[model samples]
Target: MHVVMTSAGIGRIEDGAVAVLDAPYPDPNTVIETTGSLDALGGAKVVRRIPLDGDELDLRAPLGRPRALWGVGLNYHSKAERTGRPAPDEPVLYLAGSSSVSAPGAAVRLPAEETVQMDYEAEIAVVIGRTLDRAAESEAWSAVAAITAANDMTARDVMKRTGTPALAKSFPGFTPLGASLLARDAIADPDAIGVRSWVGDERRQDSSSADMIFAIPELLARISRYAALRPGDVVLTGTPAGTGQDRDDFLRPGDTVRIEVDGVLPLTTHVRA
Candidate 1:
């Protein structure tokens, strides 16, 4: 089942029909309150049923504001090769502010600086379901609630100058999360999924979660050792090779970045440079 956040409430879409769940805003609360528990996401209380075929619904970000937005860098060998950086033994984690998230369709508004060299990083974002602290790799997967597509938009100039990832990528609307979230139960295999992206017609990234240097289970377990992960906390799996930086082809006005996680809706972000 797909979980969507609309102005009305949380929407559960399945089998061509949508059941509007009677819940509150921000997925962290909605998942637990209406369902009484995050683990049983399917048990949410439905307020109304609407056929998705001809319905027009105003959707919002599945996670209104993630409590913690953790990003992994150089997790893919291809990305490491492209950047001429060695793949790290452990997941390279950086924290971006929760306010960076925007609706899937929202435009990436660029800063007015003339040196702006905006780039796109397509990532498979994992949203934690239950709280996990010092969890083991074997049990880390169980704490996952859902998966979503994300564009980890970055300002290359800022990163190149200050060498601080959080500052470069934490701009408002930099993180375009999702149009819909795919529950973990709906995926046949959470560990293996296709992740790709495009800059208008040019396909830039083509990779799989299976190609990650540090897989999901290890990433979660590794992160939990230092900090606790709660519901709605997001982990941005590293983007693959073929970013604009590889060719010095930064984003400009009218450029659209489209990213996809196999099975979920494609995330599109227009550029306003």
Candidate 2:
């Protein structure tokens, strides 16, 4: 079932109608409530009448306020090779401020003072469902609720000049995530999906999750050792090799960036000054 948490309400996609769950799950005040406990509420009662139109509502991040936004870098073998960096034994993690979260179709503002090497990276994002510490690889799957497409927009020039990539990556509106979060059960194999990115009509990056050096399970296990992952926190798996920075081309104003992942939703955003 495709689950979408929007400002309107939580919607579940069914065969014919969309089930709209109440505002807060497992609560009585919720106009449309689901059955079972928080953990066991698996599509028992669905609130019908809600529309599936992706528009008409302001879609916030999958979660209202995530504790932290964790991003894995150079996890893709090809991307690592392009950057002249060897594949690491573990995931290379970076922190993006929670305020940087923006929804699909939003405009990504180019930092005027920074260099003009703004680039786009398409990635698969994992949404954590429960709080966990030292989670084992075998048990990590249970902690994830869904996966979505995310564009890790970056300022390459600023990163190179400042000597800190995180500085450029953490800018507000830098991460434009796709709408419509696909439930974990909806995907049969998370590691085998295809991912692609486009600048307007031209394709930029094309790759698969199978090429990831450290897969999702292993990434979760390793990251959990350092810090506790709270519910609604997101871990963005790294992008593929074909980012604009790899090709030495940057985004210009009025450019449209689109990302599509098989079985997941498509995310599109425009570049603006």
lDDT of 2: 0.75
lDDT per residue, candidate 2, 1-273, as tens digits? 565555556665565345666445522112111221123335445654555564454554544445678998789999999989999987878788878778767887888787688899999988777666998988887777767888988888887888675787877788887566676777788789788999999999999889999888888888999998766777888999999988988899999999987765578888988
For each candidate in turn, the TM-score is 0.91, 0.86
lDDT of 1 at 117: 86
Give RMSD to native, each candidate.
2.3, 3.8
What lDDT would each prediction earn against the true structure? 0.82, 0.75
TM-score of 2: 0.86
What are the per-residue Cα lDDT tens digits for candidate 1 across 1-273?
677776676788877766787654456336642342344546768888777655566667878877799998889888888888988987888999889999867887887572478889999998887788999999988878788899998888898898999988999899999877887777788668899999999899999988899998899999999999887788998899988887789888899999999877788899886
